[model samples]
Target: MSTERDRDPAGRARNARPRDALGRPLPYGAVGEERAPEGVVRPPDRALAEAQELLDAGRPFHAHEVLEDAWKSAPESERQLWRGLAQLAVGLTHAARGNSRGAATLLERGAGNIAPYAAEPPHGIGVAALRTWARGLASAAAAGRALDLRPPRLRA
Candidate 1:
């Protein structure tokens, strides 16, 4: 057997997925195949812009799809930020569909995931707004208050 340091330690571990060049977990290429593409990120800027556009259009589910691939291509540490944004987008989608409870749950999970960025969030979805929305939902839930799940009005 190869030494722990010399061998692929992660390969021997159970439930361990392979990583890409940037150490980000790549999605399974197929049902049971796990492989990274020859390239890391296809088009980070385009992906980000599309995601932003979806968000601006109040289409969180669509935005989530736009960002998933880019997030997978990012480094491991960056994944959380992207994942959090995706989750938040998902929550927003559910809210738009009139699923307040579902939205609250997803938003809470997203806030938890992005807690590290609470002080300084990324460009599009920052931690501050996420936290605020999460807290509002939590309070509404606890107090049996009705919530308006509409997205905030964007200033022109």
Candidate 2:
């Protein structure tokens, strides 16, 4: 039997199922962390603060969702930055989930994506430091070493 997915008010397919702290979807009607509404156009400052708060709370997956929204709605010039941040969050999620391979790949990729901004980072983002942090974690994870997944400061 085919199961129908949840839909938003506009009929767009949305996952209304509750999610765990790591963003894993639980069964319908299961109590889970409250998810933020999607597709809203949050200003950069708001997005950053929200994402940072989530990250600090050990909810990297939730942070990724916020960053993904920013990336999708960002201007061309800033799109990659948001994308990188989202990737970093995903990397953290993988780390917490004990997927070292996934964590390594995403951490490296995300660091590379954000490295370009090192020369002249915008929004006061700590791109250089963040890239260094991710690279170090990625290297350790790749070497079969378990590393602590601490939340990096998003701003300089």
Residue clash pairs of candidate 2: none
The regions of model 1 sitting more than 4 angstroms off are 1-45, 120-125, 138-144, 150-156
TM-score per model over all chains: 0.59, 0.94
Clashing pairs in 1: none
Weakest 10 consecutive residues, lDDT, candidate 1? 30-39
lDDT leader: 2
How close is each model in CA RMSD to the real structure?
A: 10.0, 1.8
- Candidate 2 regions off by >4 Å? 1-3
Tens digits of per-residue lDDT, candidate 1, 117-137, equal: 766555544567666776676
On the 0 to 100 scale, the lDDT of residue 63 in model 2 is 92
RMSD (Cα, Å) of model 2: 1.8
Give the C-alpha miss distance for residue 39 in model 1, angstroms: 12
Candidate 2 backbone overlaps, count? 0
Best by TM-score: 2
Could you give candidate 2's per-residue lDDT for residues 29-138 as a string of tens digits? 78999776788789998999999999999999999999999999999998999999999999999989888999999999999889889999988899999999999989
